[model samples]
Target: MLKKSLISVLCLSLLVPAVSLAETATHAVKPLTAHQERMKTCNADAKGKKGEERKAFMKSCLKGESAAAVKKAPEAKKHEKKTAKKPKTYKKLNSQQMRMKTCNVEAKGKKGAERKAFMKSCLSNK
Candidate 1:
């Protein structure tokens, strides 16, 4: 009787795991929802795009909005304008240019000779 009960317990434990695994497998193969399908398609379509282009594509695709609509949207236009306005970077100054800039600031109100003397001292000190 004990041997029969032990064998039954073992079989039950094995069966429980097999049944759970089968359930999980069925659920794992679930069909994609409409939104998920659209996202997948859009991601595939956006493979070649990058940066703002990819961002805009994904945003419009997920929202079910058209590309033209995204382009015409005020917020999207603002984003484009903001991205367009990159900060200007000045060219690096050489030693003479750098010294001149410093001396000019320091000698802002000084007259010719005084400015010349201050500039000479500043440039020499550097």
Candidate 2:
């Protein structure tokens, strides 16, 4: 029974894909929605157009806004080049400098003599 069931499952998996390919080959997938149809038409019309020119043509063609206006706007700033943020540069600190920085942070919000005393104690500790 195990062998038979395994054979049947394998057969089904192979058969299903063959049937799918045959169906696809026989029938073209037509655009069902208005937007999809417009996209299809625009893509066909935008043939031979490259880069931003193709993009502008496709946008105008899809909206039916200005099908004949396949012009590129030089100053439109449509494509902004995103620059990767530079990592924050930190000054390398010696042990004493690091200790002082930590002490200063620990002594935050204290006033006048109290702050001065806390800094003195914090700086004195190993």
TM-score of each: 0.45, 0.37
* Residue range 22-125, candidate 1, lDDT tens digits: 99999999999998899899899778777776787788878988878855555666677878877899999999999889888998899888888988898888
lDDT of each: 0.84, 0.79
Specify the poorest-scoring 10-residue window by lDDT in model 2: 73-82
Cα lDDT for residue 27, model 1?
Answer: 100
RMSD (CA, angstroms), candidate 2: 11.4
Report the lDDT tens digits of candidate 2 across residue range 97-123: 999999999888999999999999999
Q: Over 4 Å off in model 1, which ranges?
A: 65-126
